[model samples]
Target: MKFLSFSILLMILHFTTYSQTIDTAGYIRGEMHSSDDSLVGYFKFDHTFGQNGQSVWYKKDLQTTKTKRFQTYKYDYFTSDSLYMELFEVMPYGFGEIRVMVPRVINGPIQLFYFPHSTPFAIIQPKNEPYLIKTANWKKRVSYRKFKRDMREVLGESSLVYKQIEQETLKYDDIPMIVRLANMNADESTIQDYIAHKKSAATSTN
Candidate 1:
């Protein structure tokens, strides 16, 4: 009877850790994303977790992962806006490079966007086909300078949105202004207020 009671106690403790608060400041409606659907795969979105020049955002803090130092980052989920899951380098401080994993179907082919580079450089294996790995969709890696040139050519020097993209990015600190303002209709002041509130709340918490 004692052994059975102990097992039940352990199970309760195990499941309780999976439920975590998802609201975080400076993160614009913090989102909880999970790749595995298990208790251990849920990742928390923390916008204020990195140092300058790194442009880091989400950590793999699934309550189980992040124990391994080298393999700590494995956030394989996307946002409702389809703009949150992107992999970016903030040191250059622009949208020059972006990567994301999009799910088209449950248990289907995971679409990976590898930024200014290839179209799905890595094939995320399905459960049934764990051995399948292909590079058929790989494209030439575009240099950062080349990608910037392409952006300028497409948007042109007089483009308001493109110019705003650059300006907004420079003005903001850690969060990517381009991605945050992608489909948002909020004005500049409103957005700034939101960000400021978030930062203030975060500072209070710590």
Candidate 2:
């Protein structure tokens, strides 16, 4: 009888440890939406892990303990810090479907996405353009002139940021802010304000 009790205790401990390892403590709660923006259902998912390159999603209710894997959903209305952020499942050039798109500026004059797994690490779509443009990360083999030319084409001559690119004031790291400013049709004053704020924030963090 004592041997049976000891074996049951060991089994309980092992299962408890396994459950703790895979629980939804840090998972983000979101509403999965279809391509047409139709609400599917509420779910919580951790993008960090899944089976066969897909993330595991669980029903939002903790008591039910139901889970699922998804690939057909277009995007999720993920909540972080009370802000609704869209997480897109995009197929980057020369890559598989494993990567996802984190939009820097969505539905803007110039759309930019940050792809962590791809070579360029960023993708751009110019206003009213059907095809997507790929870029190389600055830390890679791409040159400054190429990066500037790409930005100029995307920003256009009418944009204030185009002039900044012409004078070589912008770098690859500034792509996120550059896209945002260009979309805003930012003037010299607005651009300067954003630059100053960003510098101040960066300094404070350090």
Question: Best-fitting candidate, measured by lDDT?
Answer: 2
> What total of clashing residue pairs does each candidate reach?
0, 0
lDDT of 1 by residue, 1-206 (tens): 33235335534532332122122332222343456531222333432223221122343353333432211134434443323332233122144433222221111122222221122223652122101111234222223334444334433566443465355432222212322332244466644555565456568899
Give candidate 2 regions above 4 Å deviation. Answer: 1-24, 36-42, 48-53, 72-146, 190-206
lDDT by candidate, in order shown: 0.32, 0.47
What TM-score, computed on C-alpha atoms, does each candidate reach? Answer: 0.23, 0.51
TM-score result, candidate 1? 0.23
- In model 2, which range of ten residues has the least summed lDDT? 133-142
Clash pairs, candidate 1, are: none
Worst 10 residues of 1 by lDDT: 126-135
Residue 44 shift from truth in candidate 1, angstroms: 1.7
lDDT of 2: 0.47
Q: lDDT tens digits, residues 6-115, model 2?
A: 33553454344323322446444445454566433344444452222335465555456676656423454333332233444443333444333232323365655433
Q: Once model 1 is optimally superposed onto the true structure by TM-score, how far is the C-alpha of residue 33 displaced, in angstroms?
A: 11
